[model samples]
Target: VAAPARRGRALTAAVVVAALVLFAVGGGAGFALTRALAGASLLPPPSAGAPSLPAITDEAPARVTTASAATANGEQGAEFTIEVGADWTSFLEQRANRGLAPSTVVHLVAPTGGYEVSVQRFADYYPRHSVEDYLSLVRSRWPKGQYFGEATDVTDPLDPAAPEPPVQFSYRTVEKATELGRAADAGGRDLRRSRYSRVLPRGADLWVVEVVFPTEQEEMGRSRLFDTIAGTFAVVG
Candidate 1:
């Protein structure tokens, strides 16, 4: 159908950092690395910036959470601490859309480390598109990817075989994956239409944190509201 879905909005410097996150994603989205050298910029120029994932370390604003995996996702990885909002409940609740509960998930890989990609307005768009179609697109575009395969379309929820959350939802584990994430910065980026890209250092791995279900999730995708999630890399433990 379409190319593997990549988050273009991180179109900022989040490039290298986010691509690094994809390596762990072990799926099509991980291919964001192979797509860009300086990183891909989807928008026009002059005012555009580059890519930037959230923070991997901690800071003063939020108290450190003593991230379990420690540093980047790796065996015997370096560790870091992160502090989310002091009143996360009130903070998240305020940011979330009305009637929607704010959800903050931290997926940590054991021993080594894992990245956390949190989301708020989680929805089941799969009802219309279906994960089967999305997975097919993923494998077709990123045939070399480890997780992309021609599994049967998840049966519709009404079918007895479908899992809870229906054919639309799932999560990944903290695995050795470790792919690539970064941006290709053309001098003078255009915020309205820029895609980020970059190259990784030798031996470095990539990870990605994807957010979905915002009003503009389909049109804007991860790029829609990446700012709140982007700078978080160094904020958590």
Candidate 2:
């Protein structure tokens, strides 16, 4: 199969777009700057009918990075790994040693302009008590949202108060998630899933590296992806 069209990892456009639009609407300058660092692929226009988010990177001029990594979660535990072009070097270099979960997904915006790092967990699901809520609740642009014990702030560069809600209402609420089986594409080509998508700045690309296993070995499939991400980690500068 062909490689996934990810300016970041092997992530398909749908995944990136959903994630990108989710954050862009809530975040302003921070959102713009983040997409710029993600390579031009993240500059797509937000979904038409949905609440809109600006696509600033599409107009900006910048030099992005592309890189290859062994693991996103240092050496401890990880279910999957992701690598982008040289554009993402600074982000990977800075936060490689943080405490990451087994199914953790680590994302880095550019560092030049204040970068926003977005992460999603594999094992943990919705609810404020879950790991996902814990990370989004932290104050980045504004005083963190008042909500607790629920999935909140899946988007970055979020505005505390605004008409356009940037973050995607938790997956638990928005859409039904399908657990994918194990698969491999050495080339990491493009794919479209119900998940999400992103529009890059310009001339850049995006990809998502997922940990997939056959439908038969469900638990083992997830475990394999986790190990792959943890062991094959690298910090490209």
Residue 105, candidate 1: alpha-carbon lDDT: 31
Off by over 4 Å in 2: 1-55, 59-77, 81-85, 90-107, 120-237
lDDT of 1 by residue, 121-190 (tens): 1223223433343334333433242332122322222223322322223222211212332233433332
Tens-place lDDT digits, model 2, residues 92-152: 3223212432333345554342222233333222121332332343322122332222233
lDDT of 1: 0.31
Instruction: Score each candidate by Cα lDDT.
Output: 0.31, 0.32
Please give each candidate's TM-score.
Answer: 0.23, 0.21
Global fold similarity of model 1 (TM-score):
0.23
Separately for all candidates shown, the number of backbone clashes (residues 3 or more apart, or on different chains) is: 76, 68
Lowest summed lDDT across 10 adjacent residues in model 2 is found at 197-206
Q: Which segments of model 1 are wrong by more than 4 Å?
A: 1-64, 70-75, 81-83, 87-105, 108-202, 216-225, 235-237
- How many clashing pairs does model 1 include? 76
RMSD (Cα, Å) for all candidates, in order, is 27.9, 29.1
